[model samples]
Target: MSAEVSGVRIGVEERRARLRARQLAAVDDVAEVVEGLVALHATDPATVFLSVAARLCRPSGAIAAVEEALYGSGSGPGSGPALVRMMAMRRTMFVVSRESAPDVFAAAGRDIAARERTKLLEHLARGGGWDAAWLAEVEAEVEAALDRHGESGGARLSALVPRLREQVVVGRGKPYETTQNVASRVIRVMAAEYRIERRRPAGSWTSGQFRWARAEPLPERPVGPAREAVVRAWLRAYGPGTEADLKWWTGWTLTEVRKALKAVGAETVRLDDGAGHILPGHILPGDTEPAEPPPPGPVLLPGLDPTPMGWQDRDWFLPRSHRAELFDGTGNVGPTVWWGGEVIGGWAQRADGSVVWRQLTDRGAEAAGAVDRAAAELVGLLGGVRITPRFRTPLERELSA
Candidate 1:
């Protein structure tokens, strides 16, 4: 005979309302989002970088908006060439949500194209070397051909030549390798008819990937707003986080982050995390998790998702000491496989969409089966409608208790 009364039971609706309120508070307009990141930078530099990246590169966001803000006028490098050079050194990789890859590529391509033209013309004027004269001659020819095409679809190819050349140089490691190299280098020059860089002829596509001909020099100016937007976005995705947390994610200085945050006023909130420390608002729920959070789904998060890499005090979801285990040297979070709110494993998909998983520990076949389901879910996100499990690796056999 069991008739038991609970010590403390809160109605589910009440908990949901509280949680919803906290989540809703985190919802911010694009502008507000921008402001918050500026503030975030003030408190934590690295975090601002990561947060901004998260914003510009969500599963469904655009890079152009942020790009313009950074390079358009304010604090960022105003010159396109300088911006490209600067961005090149920014080696930090941001994951382009699988769905937004097209748009991201387009925007990045535009930036690449504009910067290449300027670089070509400027480099030619400066008299770099052999590649310069050849590039200059090619620009003239390409422009003449474009004149015939009357700036239509064909001109796009003309415009794109310089871009392709730039990619080749960057990817291939040498500018004058063979006929293909000479052709690409000359094509870019002919298309632009503007002076070209002899030492740094732009590159082109090879085997699919675009290569950077010459090392992109660092950006000449600060990409303020654009950078700020990226920071804000990260916080939105993984907030209620500390400025230090933000710093760990971004690579900016605390001073820069502070300036950005100051720009964003009440739109951003600072909440205490039980301790005296204040952090971004979203991560801190006014209430605790209901006996359960959502039933863990098999979600295949992009390599750059904020969910896994955004927080600094990750003990809530992961063992704090091992946080570095999931991250690479550049602070890029690897692809993570999740069963619930926490990460249980990691997976990778080859270009062909073959799925492979590596579990953190041996959980046996039952766990292996769950990973299979999760991998399928991930493949769907990557545009592959269906995925077949090819293989799995367990870190070690079941440990003796």
Candidate 2:
């Protein structure tokens, strides 16, 4: 066993400041923020666009820019997307830079794909007349259908693949059991494998409805090296994270987390909360102050923004007392108000497309004023498109209602 390194410290305030410089600081490129923040949480659909807007110096064109990166036809025709939406760590959806998608998939997405396929197979087994062979046949047919007819909505694809329209009963013995068509699940599996991707919105960018198309194959990578690469990327943005933080964020086993940390040369450090670890040189032995410390931000981050979801242990940026109001029961975050890099409150979009906010804890008049400006800026950024977080928290729901 290797020896450990300790006696080093990164306090809450420093961590907050680091966060501002690393992620909260404004940038011009959409892809830059995506990679810099590791990846943007995309389950909510709107989260990716909002997260990008939050980081841009001028955000008026954020939605168009993001859409182009994801579905752009390139400089000419038939060129691929610059970013990829994948099932990532913790079985969640995220948008990652195209170059990083392979490692992201190898380290996190592949296992999730395997689990989803297995679960679907098990459900089919319970229903009978459906097995792995049947599932594979349907998958191939769906792929061919998408190719033959170009991209298609789920219902349209289902109509094209007659076999896919059949329903399966899930949770047969449970009170909340329901039937679901196989089209979506099969498409989900293919998406997880990078065999296909969502091509375009059936409605607005905020709409979950999407057309499906065959996706470019992800670059192949070794799992071990990829895990190390992913951990390194995480640490570059969210180092000093505890083992639990890495493990929980990745949905990897504790053993995998430990092995990857060792491979990445992570060193133990003391956080304000407890013992944590950071990549070597993450905090220099005697690192000097940045030429300029980040301002007390009052940045408004959307719910499920990558920074808030980057780690399982959030004490450095999120206070324990605000946990209940800020997150849904299952741990999805709500739109947050931040100042000095710490999450200070929540915000919501009202029925009239207005953005309203309230502080969970006071950071004073100056911070509040700054947050007010940020809110007004968000209102202009939104431009009357009402966005409801897919997962609503108590605070957001109350504010919106």
Candidate 2 colliding pairs, count: 0
Worst 10 residues of 2 by lDDT: 279-288
Off-target runs (Cα >4 Å) in candidate 2 are: 74-79, 171-178, 274-292
Q: What is the C-alpha lDDT of each candidate?
A: 0.39, 0.83
**Tens-digit per-residue lDDT, 1-401, candidate 1:** 01122232333233233322322123223233333322222111122222343333242232333333322333445432211211111223232322222232232222444555666555444433335555556555554544454332322444545533332222234565332233443444322221221111122100112222222222232355544544444444454445566556554466655554444321334444433344443222222344333333344544444455455555544444444545555555555555434556666656566566666644467667877975664445345422211112121111100
Looking at model 2, residue 322 earns an lDDT score of 88
> Per-residue error at 401 for model 2, in Å?
1.8
Deviating ranges (above 4 Å) for candidate 1: 1-231, 248-250, 266-294, 302-306, 311-315, 320-325, 328-330, 349-356, 361-369, 377-401
lDDT of 2 by residue, 1-401 (tens): 14354667677667777788888888988978887888889898999999999998888899999899888865676466888899989889989888899999999999889998898888788854599889889889988998899989989998999988898887787998888877777888888888889877899989889888988887889999999989888887776577777888899998998888778777666566523434322322233353244677778889999888877878767778889999999999999988887888999999998899989889899999998898998999898899999999999999999
Q: Candidate 2 local accuracy as lDDT?
A: 0.83
Give candidate 2's root-mean-square deviation (CA, Å): 2.8
